[model samples]
Target chain A: MTTKRSITVTVNGQQHQTEVEPRMLLVHYLREVLDLTGTHIGCNTSQCGACVVMLNGEAIKSCTVLAVQADGGEVLTIEGLAPEGGLHPIQEGFWEKHGLQCGFCTPGMIMASYQLLKNNPHPTETEIRRGLEGNICRCTGYQNIVKAVQDASERMSTSAETPVPAGD
Target chain B: MSVPAAFDYHPATSVDEAIALLQQYGDEAKLLAGGHSLIPAMKLRLSQPEHLIDIGKISSLSYIREEQDHIVIGGLTTYVQIEQSDLLRKHFPLLPEATSMVGDQQVRNRGTIGGSIAHSDPAADLPGVVLALKAEIVVQGPQGKRTIPADDFFVDTFTTALAPDEILIEFRLPKATGSTGSAYDKLANKASHYAIAGCAAVITRGQDGSCSAASIAITGATVRTIRARAVENALVGKQLSETVIAEAVSHATDGEDMIVDIHGSEEYRRKMAAVVARRAIMRALERI
Candidate 1:
């Protein structure tokens, strides 16, 4: 039999202390244990983007990461993207640009887009396509998704008063 | 979803600790880097080992630096880190270019170079690139540390020279000489991240503007990434012309033992390998 271990992790800006089995995936911990089901598991394989999340400010597929691997680390789920009453620029862009049809891939797509924008605030259309190549959206045909990222880039660039350095 | 079968979890903060844990567990233990590959396999029951030694927290094993004679990349350095490193862009542009093509942004964020090398999937882009670059793999075991050339590092399909108690530390690539350039070309599968046929080429031009040395490594067309000696032999002492490049590409799959699957037939892969190798070599030569 496997042993259960105590792990302390910060999820979506909140600390959670829990005991989990060695086999528990970070996706399971987020959905079943912490009740943050915003992170969906589309495919057991890592091919799908439905399980994408931010660990230590980098986008990763949570389904592939074990909870023990994430011990003592800070994780950002789709829930954390819009912590305040207002939606994040990416989320707003998705809605305004009609980036989704069934909305199954939205949370992961939005999280992936957030990471891309964080690193390259203003990405070209080709860059945006390459950035999101891992995220498979079965619906929408990706026309609006690319449009959403472009819209988010424009909105973010205009809202900022102080100029942020390129390539953050 | 039922939980992954029972397995012990050992979190190691240092290389020594990780090596010790691997020794204690023997062949029953597997090192977990980003869990991008092993974990998914475990979930599918393809690999049901007794223990998982987690090494993701070893922050010291994540860096990309330029040494006096070579570029050293920590084993735990994520693909995303390589994609963003200015050092890689300046010294090893081919590595970053290939890394950028790895399974999207999410996989790049979690997959480590070491993990990918250790897994040694024949279709993986890095293995082929490293082979062409003539890189070296540094491994730490219970006994001590040793460096294995990239050619000898990959033993067979999904296998490496890594001992049961050994942990791959980092990879080192010698600095390119003057008039040297490299390129990686991959025909990516639409659904799965596996490559249909991938080729990596490194070419060094002579003082007379002719090819002095050439190395071409091919992946996804064979059981393991193998250098195309026929192509390399044909390129040396030849001008970087379209005819010579085509002749070189024709011999790319001369000695390859290719893998045939539903993705493509062995005949198709053999043909594509030749085409891609020529394209990659031509592109590399253009940059020289």
Candidate 2:
């Protein structure tokens, strides 16, 4: 028998109160309970990084974290990246650079890139490649994905008044 | 999707609370540190603890401070914090460098040093590095806190000297003094990013450039991380040149039951252990 845990989590600036089993994973809670299916589950292990999300502004693998573990934390999925009418720079870069083939790994790649670019507004080519190491893209060979991140960094740097520095 | 079996989750806020929870649950409970390793093991059914005492939220256990003659890092300090620490980068570069090779950015953001040490994976990088640095770990239990030397901490594969009711608190390492250098060299398996063979070496050179003291530790070759005392003995009092260091590091794989799995054969691991040790020694010498 499993015990159900009631948790309050803020997702993409919205507060959510839900009851979940202790064994329920964050990925399932997002997909099934809230119907936020943008976070994909690949390999079902932490290594793949297909289920990456922004937990309190840090990129984390949602598949490895239980729903109860994320209580009282802020989570940002790929669904929240774009505005009501337009796309975020990261999404725009993906569209412009054709960052995906099968589109399975795009959400995780975008979320991971969101954190990377937030920290480093302008990263070197090697830095861009190394930054995306956590999010694996089987389709595009990561060339376009790298280009997309670089493009997003460029776009974001030109738009924001004061760019945020990488954390200590 | 892989899901963990049914278990009770308890988020602990303090060390005393954590210890008390551990005492109540006994061996059926597992401490949840960053959950980078524990979560994966639980999801795969490799570990099925009835209760999980999460120590991640205990702010008191997350710190890195410089003491009188040593540096004390709290058990919950994440790898990302260690990697970005200017103090660690300037003083103990090997720790930050080795931690950078742990996993991708996300894994480092959540994996804690104490959790890694307690897990004690033979292929893990921090164990060998800590062993080479002669770091001491603090474990707290019902009785009180006790310090355990790095050498005696690791008992066997996936096992440590930690009792069921004990929790590792922090690691204390003596500050690196003048003429001391350390390096960690690893050959990682591309798929999982676990080390195939890793070697950590710390050397202190005299004014004459002759090695005064040396500590060489190896992982991924044996069932447990161990110091290569023969290699250390051969390097001391000897000028650290290419040939001399090479000869000394040749003993890294001696007298050990090397791990043989799909990654590499026993012979292959032995050969690579020597190679990594040689590289690590050379790097350490260069740093000195």
Candidate 3:
């Protein structure tokens, strides 16, 4: 018999309670079960970071994490980074700087950059490159992604700390 | 998409609870911490366990603290915690250095030191660093708790000295003091992020600037992480110069089982093993 586990995950400010199979990956749970398709799965083997998400305020490869493992945890996916009315600075930076081409790796890249900028605030070019090592992009060659992160860092540093809006 | 086979899951809240679970399930159960390594293996069908004891939520086992004679790192402490630890960075900097090369930011956030060492992957970074540091691991079984030195902890690839019912609880690393220097250098396989060849060196110099104690451990070139005793023997009581370090590191591939895969041939890996060992030792000398 297949064992099922119950999990309460807060995705993008909304709380979700679901019963998932013990073998289910978190990325599959978000996409197949929860219909949060924004988080892509590039490599199931965990080499690519397309399944990156913020688990309890830290960036982790969702594909590598089992759904049951994330039970009772706060998860902030790519969908939850921005407020209801607007896009987050990272999204704005990607748009303004043309951070991605094809956009498949964009979500993971942005999510990883989100963690990097949050921790380092003003990361150097090398640090930004190092920060996104897990993520792979076949398009844009990552020059624009670096620019987008730098842009977001500049905007975020000059503005208030709460880049993600609350109460909506 | 890859998915693991169905298995009973138990979230263990404490060390005793986890140990009891392990004892109950015995060989059928596997402890899941971080899941960065085990889950991937399960997905590939490389490993199958009827039961999985999730120790990731065991908050008591995730820590890094300074003790009187050594540093105590909890079994579940993630790589990110180690990378950002001031105590580790100030003292045993090789840990952070090697951990930085493990995977990426996200992997580090979830991959625990205990999980890495316990998994004992031939190319894993932590084992090499632990072997270099002469660390000891604390294990708890149905009988009681026992300490195993790093040298004896890793038995073979994908295997450890841990019994089926034993749970690794903590890593005790000797505190680095005085003129101590350590470094880790690796040539990462660009695709898999596993090391093609990696070496870690720890050296403590005497008052007269001579090598008082030295340790060298290398990974990826063999089926298991190995201490390059030949290299250590050459470095002790000698002045660490470029020429001396070069001669000492050349013996890194001596008396070892080398791994041959699509990544590199036996001959190539053997040569690169020495190269990385040289680079690691030189870097350690610079820090000293």
Interface RMSD of each: 1.5, 1.0, 0.9
B1-288, model 3: which lDDT tens digit per residue? 688888999999987899899888888899999998999999998888989999999888898999899999999999989998999998898999998899988989999999999999999898999999999999998899999999998888888999888888899999877798999999889977899999999999999999999999999988899999999999999988889988988889897888899999988998899999999988888898
Q: What is the DockQ of candidate 1?
A: 0.72
* lDDT tens digits by residue: candidate 3, A24-72: 8999999999999999999888878898989888888999999888887
Best by DockQ: 3
Model 3 off-target regions past 4 Å? A160-162, A165-168
C-alpha local distance difference test of each model: 0.87, 0.89, 0.89
Q: Per-residue lDDT of A59-146 in model 1, one digit per residue for the tens?
A: 8888888888788788888887765576877888899999999999998899889889988999999999988887889885599999
Off by over 4 Å in 2: A161-168
Name the TM-score of candidate 1: 0.95
With a 3 Å backbone cut-off (N, CA, C), the pairs that clash in candidate 2 are none
B82 Cα displacement, candidate 3 (Å): 0.7
Candidate 3, position B115, lDDT: 94
Compared with the true structure, what per-residue lDDT tens digits does model 2 show for residues B1-288? 589889998989998999999999898999999998999999989999999999999978888888888888999999999999998877788999899999888898889999999999999999999999899999999999999999999899999999989999999998877699889999998866788999998999988889999889998888899999999999999987889988887888789988999999999999999999999988988897
Candidate 2 structure quality by residue, lDDT tens digits, A1-168: 757789999987788999888889999999999999989999787777899998877999998888888998988888877645668888888999998889999999988888888778789989988888887877755999988988888888787543332210
DockQ of each: 0.72, 0.78, 0.87
